[model samples]
Target: MAKLYSKQKLAGQSMLPKKETIAFILNYSKALSIKKIGKMSFEIIAN
Candidate 1:
């Protein structure tokens, strides 16, 4: 599960809800920015 402080921001960016798990089939060869947050954790997962 992921946690987010701003649901509006996510919505504005067309991202899924924090508690929602999303699955995609597309593969990217470029860099992307992803943020992961938990109750006591904050992480950035990107490539």
Candidate 2:
């Protein structure tokens, strides 16, 4: 996803392993689904 790519860029770190990115996206989506956290964008999360 774009968010994942952006995160990798923002970190200035080497590319994250595919599995780790996938897991993070899954968990993040689950968290979003469970609660209506407002305006929690990728930029916020990355920081």
Candidate 3:
């Protein structure tokens, strides 16, 4: 997950807000992926 965030940052993609907890980011990412929400990537959702 850290690697993912780092890559996203490097790519200038949206990231999980710094004010948000890591736990929140992980769970939210999981939930979205599991539900296949919007067929979007985490980067898009983070934005």
Candidate 4:
């Protein structure tokens, strides 16, 4: 979970989604792609 207060403090009291949140989103997306690749590879081998 992203800490809203910490993000606000980091941005000098500015309002934003926070860099951590963006990084988490990016990382999650990459993980999803990796999972998809694994599944595809398994399907190919099974076929």
Output the number of the TM-score-best candidate: 4
Predicted model with the maximum lDDT:
2
lDDT of 2 by residue, 1-47 (tens): 34556555565767667898999888776565332458553433322
- Best-to-worst order by TM-score is 4, 2, 3, 1
lDDT of 3 by residue, 1-47 (tens): 24555445566767656655877778787655322358753443433
Backbone clash count for every predicted candidate, in the order shown: 0, 0, 0, 0
- Give the range of the ten consecutive residues with the poorest summed lDDT in model 2: 38-47
Locate the minimum summed-lDDT window of 10 residues in model 4: 38-47
Error of 3 at 39 (Å): 11
lDDT of 2 at 11: 58
Q: Better model by TM-score, 1 or 4?
A: 4
Better of 1 and 3 by TM-score: 3
Give lDDT tens digits, candidate 4, residues 1-47: 76567545554766789899999888776555322564473222211
Score each candidate by Cα lDDT: 0.45, 0.60, 0.57, 0.59
Ten residues in a row with the worst lDDT in model 1? 20-29
Q: What is the TM-score of each candidate against the true structure?
A: 0.15, 0.33, 0.28, 0.37
Model 3 lDDT, residue 14, Cα: 73
How high is the lDDT of residue 45 in model 2?
33
lDDT of 1: 0.45
Residue range 1-47, candidate 1, lDDT tens digits: 78667665655775455532222222231234445566555444344
